[model samples]
Target: MRAADIDKLVSVGRPTIAPDGAFAVFAASRPDLTANRAVGQLWRVDLPDGTPRRLTRGVSDTAPRLAPDGAAVAFLRADAKGKAQVFVVAAGGGEPVQATDARAGVGSFAWSPDGARLAYTARTPEQGRYGTVEGLEPIAEAPRRITGIRWHANGLGYLADRPAHVFLIDVPSVDAEPFYEPAPAVRPEGEDAPKKQLVAAEAVQLTSGAGSYGGVAFTADGSEILAAVDEIETDRRDLSSRVVALSADGGTEREVLARTALLSVDEIVVASDGTVALQASGVGEGRVDFIAPAVGLYLLEADGPRLLTDPDVLDLGEVGSHITAVGDDFLVQSRSRGTVSLVRVSRDGATASVFDGDVEVAGHAAAGERIVVAYATPDSFGELALVDRGALTDFGAPLRAQGLVLPGEREITGRDGYPIHGWVAVPAGEGPFPVILQIHGGPYASYGIHLFDETQVLVDAGYAVVYCNPRGSAGYGRAHGRSIRQAMGTVDFHDVIDFLEGVVAGDERLDGARVGVMGGSYGGYLTAWTIAHDHRFAGAIVERGFLDPVSFQGTSDIGSFFGDEYVGVDPVQMAAQSPMAVVDRVRTPTLVLHSELDYRCPLEQATRYYAALKRQGTEAEMLVFPGEDHELTRAGQPRHRVQRFDAVLQWWARHLPVTG
Candidate 1:
């Protein structure tokens, strides 16, 4: 795929199965070149050999939830103010009616058991803040008091002043007419009577106080809503969450269900019998640990909490993974050997694969005996496929027609004889071509079977792309992931070098002498470190790097505990692993790319690295994008993503030019 192919790329997500297993609804999104934004809408497909068809027409619609009674489908759609709110439409067909008018918009929502009401979470901003009162601008708002560690987030800035709270709103009846209230009688004498004002049903706030709530769900009887609450205390350091039970009627205070003190909960699911299932990871010594002991499944029963899945064996996807309770057991998405599959874990920790193969399962939903999954492979983007049968809808067919290069999978032997899984994507030419060693962010993140656009773009530019999941990467077992903890640039660095060398030695179409290394975040750290230790690359691109852990801890969002867990606290020990300490040894031409608004790694990392390289008389350049966070390549603006691709190609052309 070329750089412009990004506009034609399509993916499907957020699949929800009907209660009777008759149909499934999902959301499909594609970039709009004209508007320079992503456009999404709802799509539906009937079960048992039925064609998929468009269900709703919205600019941006996502997070579809099928009602319990199967009479309606509720989803989030952006309003005129660009805030996502809940909208409901009939299961068969009809216009979608807006059910909420929240000022701060909704984060997530779930249908009640009886399908009469919906439970959702939204930020409850202070009355005088966030434009809550008319004529009060954000710039004119009062200054915030310094209190919490998590006061500022990456995309949502200054969150301490407006903590999220649970809310309940009744669904509007499709057959009923629009409700309106008369205007006040005290109008100006010169003007005629004002038109009646349309009034939406008010939503009741369920929880309050200095905390944020998410992942809401109702019990079997729909009496209480279970939500995960994060209370940021100044004394506490670990970012953990507590499960709470709130009355659905807003009649009483929320009751603490489970503390989950030492564990960090990413998602939660409630069973029919009031059992709470959590996908959590252990934070040893109350500090965030890296990559080791992957997130596992835990059950909060009446007696106590019990481990349901083995963390060493199965790594829960956590980001796009879904957990559904089935009787006494649960079905969740787990990553193993670079592939994500749906697994069934019994109450006693007996794990069985429900859907396992070469595909990367992004999301899944099931009801009764019927199951559907949204998956992606090396050639296809995410598609809606049935359990036993193959793909039911081809959402990526248009992009596939534009020609996508499929990566060839390989297994390399590391310096220590450990096996490293990797892939190589070569251009369509016959002669040898320059190679690009691409590294993924999150030293824990892996390069999987998904069709990545970055690799494809390089291949289309007549350059070979190589990527591997060395030690410290996820999707391998816990031992493999934790092998490099506190020893970042030692064995993991050797493993990366070994994998790249092994691929070059075996492949005939790659020119090893002309290679360019590039990566972002943790990958950027490794790229900078790799060029410094071994001057084999002609050029390098370091984007959003964590060059110094000491400075990162003070500025980054997760920096407070991330460096302490991975790099340790000793200044001398941290210096040995940091790239900033050894950047003077670099001789390769480098391009330092960064985002101005990125809070994950912060912009100082790029500036510091670039300045050090330039001061030492080494060739260097820096590129900064405005109004973008750390997720620039993945979810940035469409025009900006294309512009980034153009810039990368220009850098490669100047340093390691690919020739036929």
Candidate 2:
């Protein structure tokens, strides 16, 4: 797939299964290439038949939640001013009614069990002075000095420095009288000050502090609320959160359920029986895990907290699983070995797979006896399917690659004698094709059996692309991930070379003489280091890679912390491991790509490496992106993202010949 082709595909997000399980709701955004725009709308899919239908018109809608009665659907919609407000539409489809007119935006909401009120968190400006106002004086007979100094402020100038608060909205009844009445104007003591009456509405501020509330959930009985709280402290990222139970009426009295040390909670789902399941993660690892270990599922029983499911029997590899609670069952959307599955876990520990395949499962819901699931894979954009508790039929077929073929996948033994896995994608109807060895970032991340467009594009362009999970990659275990803590370019880079040699021996389509290398971030750093240490590769593309650890330590945002974890030494050893320090050995053509706003591995790393390459008389070019951060490859500007891929493709084409 070409970059332009992949960019045309619609992006699906925030799939939600309806309460009755007869339908599912999800958001889809299609890119308008000509207008350089994106249109996001809500969609619904019927259960058992997997038929999709558009629910909302041209509006940016997200976070769809079905009411308990299944008569209405509540979702967050962005207005013309880009402010998110809550709106409710009939489950059968109709004009959405605005529920809340919050200016700062509303998210992380929960509908009360009785469906009489809705609770959500919204950003509010703190009333205080951010800094001293200069050249300010009261227009009076005598000048006066400003009295008080407040720590924070609200309004336009001080908006970004404000905090967030939780609020409750009451559902207006059809027969009841209006709850709000406009307040009358008030006059000052001597000189009358203009004052307007405010509406007589009932809204309670749940928590007051410099903290943020996220992942809010209501208890089964709707008597209490559970939320994850992160307060601003010395270390901004070091969040200490506990499941706090607040009164449904917004009372100040609250109690903490579970206290965590380093892990930050992400989402929470409360069952009808009062069991709460959450997705959380600690520092360093991005994988979200189910908090209470040894308890596959927990139940808040009369006696105490009890384990509902057996830990050993259930597969816990689904770290970032999404869970939905029904009457006595829990619908889990989990991924294991790159395959996503929708499973129903009963109160008695019995589990049944409603749907399972190579595709990625997004949302799942169970209403009464019916179940609905939303899934997406590399080949297909988005799919909505329905499955019964006991049904065995497959609603949607697994996605398969067309017109493109992958070379045989194999495992090669690393220099340390450990088996390393890799895949070789060979161009269709070709021989002796130029090879591009692609390395994935995240020394702790793995390149699994997942769909990727860039690799496929290389194969489509008559080049064999090789990808591997070198040492320090995850999924194998903790020890393998810890191997590259201080050995950066040594073991990990050699593992790639060994994997490439294995691919050359097994696949006849790959050309050993015309090999190119490419990677981003950690992979980018390795690409730069690879060409420096060896001349096997004919060309290389280093995208946002760190060239010198010593320079990165001072230039990057988290440099001080990362340098200690990865290098385990001071600036001296870091300089020794840097590719820029050994640039004289580089002989292959190289392209250095970086973003100006990348604070992780700042652009200076690339600039220094490019200068060294030029001073050494080595073939090198630098591609710097303006107004882009470290996420340029994934979530950067659309135009520059396309340019990034084009630059890499062109660079490789110029140095490595594509054979037919």
Q: What is the TM-score of each candidate against the true structure?
A: 0.96, 0.79
- lDDT (C-alpha) at residue 621 in model 2: 94
Model 1: lowest-lDDT 10 consecutive positions: 251-260
RMSD in angstroms between candidate 2 and the native structure over all alpha carbons: 7.1
- In order, what is each prediction's RMSD in angstroms? 2.2, 7.1
What are the per-residue Cα lDDT tens digits for candidate 1 across 518-557? Answer: 9999999999999999998989999989898989988888
lDDT: which candidate is best? Answer: 1
Per model, how many backbone clashes are there? 0, 3
Worst 10 residues of 2 by lDDT: 148-157
Q: What residue pairs clash in candidate 1, if any at all?
A: none
TM-score of candidate 2 on Cα atoms, chains taken together: 0.79
Off by over 4 Å in 1: 179-199, 254-257
Q: How many backbone clashes does candidate 2 have?
A: 3
Model 2 C-alpha lDDT per residue in residues 1-660, reported as the tens digit of each score: 666655445556656666656667777764444544455678877665655678888546777887777677788887655778777777778777667766577867888888877888887643332211334332322322222122222112222344566777775332333334445656576855544322123456687676667677888898888887755434222333565777877546464544433345556788776777654443434212222222145444444334455544443334345667777777765444335677777777688877876566666666777666556554544555556432222222322334435345678987778787877788776587888999987765556444566776787777888888887665454555667777788888889999998878777777788889999988988888888888888889988887788777556755545655677565677666778778889899889899887877888888888998898798889999988888777666667777887888788778886842
Model 1 Cα displacement at 48 (Å)? Answer: 1.5
